[model samples]
Target: MEETISLKENYEIVKKRIWLILSITIIAALISALVSLFVLTPIYQSSTQILVNNSESEISGFDINDIRTNTELISTYSVIIKSPAILDIVIEELELNRSSGVLSSQINVKPENNSQVVSIIVQDANPTLAAEIANTIARVFKTEIVALMNVDNVSVLAEATVSEKPSPIKPNPTLNIAIAIVVGLMSGVGLSFLLEYLDNTVKTEQDVEKLLELPVLGSISQIKEQEENAFVSSQQNQPVGSVTIES
Candidate 1:
């Protein structure tokens, strides 16, 4: 037979196990909050922009051809900015005790599509260092690109700056807690239904009828030990009336 449960039964199941569900959800959220606040390392981000222009006159010597040429150069500039040649000088200037590969991993170079602007982004545990690294990479790339590519087109457009109260980009506690709450709620509801389905012990007439597929004739009412003993004591104390009846 295909078994089906009504909404009321589901509600009852959830109501019966609501405490368990709540406990699990609360524990998961707390764990996530703790991990986000204390266990995970926070990362700070800083970015600087560099412009590629071949012409000295920004207003008059510009044309569609120049724009197209500069746009094409941005792609090459993105790669050259992250190259060891540029990153090595940046590391030396910053006195960073890391290899070129490690420094490259911390730096990201991206060029705006159909534009002459390239952005260099850096992430680190320290906000000041992140800004410094981004600005240093831009400065080093602009100085070296003239010698490496033989084109004095790269110019620092925007420098990265550190604010008085810089915020970390990663380890967002609110977002982490929100995700944990959703996951915890789902897991709790799932576990509640699973436990209800696995429990096979019958405790009521309805359960008996459902399991046996038969109508119950009657049921014996359960009496507590103290109540049964009191009833027996009352019967024994009523002895005078019985003796008069026998005589």
Candidate 2:
């Protein structure tokens, strides 16, 4: 016959194995903490902003409608800021060893909604290098656009500064360790139940009765003192053809 266990019993089993759960959780948390703090390298970020104003000016000698049209082309300018034409010049001028494509990937350009202002953000391990790259890209883009499109509306709005305190944007150790602890606790509980299921030893009278399907007349305790005494008396007495001992 199948047996049913109560919620209380299940809770008891987990309670009995709480130590295993705690041990696994502690180990996982330690590993995660060590990996996050020591094994992984921390990365820093810096950003620069550029303004894209297409308003016609007296010095530029461009028509108001042409200025408006150029203003609408801010999206195109954002894309061009990261293109090979601009990035290549910036790389050559700065003597950067990275390729145009690789350098471009480090840049993110976005224009303000319904406005002509474009913001360029650069990220690198070194804050000064990041700011230099951002400023260079903006200057190069501005010069190239002025000559190529006959428009001089693009300008640098802000420059990135070196942060006094390191800005950590990735590899959150606390969050990682928290998740690892939860996962480890769950795994430990699952393993405990699995081991319990695989165990086949009879640990209680109920188990013996159920397995044998027979009534138990009586149960007696085997006393160690009585057993020892009986063993000693048997050795002292010599046996005849048939031997018997009284208890």
Candidate 3:
């Protein structure tokens, strides 16, 4: 059977150090919020989709061969979109100071499974630049594929538009704070248990009996300072005409 803690023991543990636990949790959440808000760079993402089917030829019936061929070719198209062939041209056109390698790292080409549509997603610090890059990548890939592979089937299905107010897709503040709270709570509880375990000084008569493995015959009552001083004064007064009065 799994070991279980009594409710009273759990309550005592929590009550003993509730302030420490709350302080740690609140501090952790605040730190996480601050990091998400100001410390880390916010990355804005924009996406554009490209359709890799015959735009010229319109068919009424579904062609399995063409569908399979289009889906299979989309994988190669994904690689070509990120290759230096297209990215280098895009860099020159955009006049971006970054290298093709750096730009490639920020771009992601994701193709839908068993579909001819490919999504070109760009992430940048500037929201407008991210949207421009996404659109430019799709436009550049369309132009380059015809020259590189003599293929003209690829076309931009939807152009990327810049948002007036774009939010970052990374470093989610709420999620980060939630995770920090859990981490802080665990750390606080673990530290509390560690401190409890390390504390071994006896505090009760039962502890003395348990350690000595003998019955505790008696325990000395703790004497207050006032009572001790009175006893000493009475002893001094006994030599100078004093009478004892037992309570």
Model 3 bad stretches (over 4 Å): 1-11, 55-62, 215-247
lDDT of 1 at 118: 88
Of candidate 3, the 10-residue stretch with the lowest lDDT total is 1-10
| Per-residue accuracy of model 3 over 207-226 as CA lDDT, tens digit each | 69868999988889999999
Show the lowest summed lDDT stretch of 10 residues, model 1: 238-247
Residue 244 lDDT, candidate 3, scale 0-100: 76
TM-scores, all models, native as reference: 0.82, 0.69, 0.81
Which tens-of-lDDT digit does each residue in 22-141 have in candidate 1?
A: 998999999999999999999999999989887554556648888788898887887887889888888888898999899889888888776788889999999999999999888888
lDDT of 2 at 232: 76
What are the lDDT scores of the predictions, listed in order?
A: 0.87, 0.79, 0.88
For residue 72, model 3's alpha carbon misses the true position, in angstroms, by 0.6
The per-prediction CA RMSD against the true structure, in angstroms, equals: 4.6, 7.0, 4.3
lDDT of 2 by residue, 135-192 (tens): 8888888789987778777777887777677666657898999999999999999988
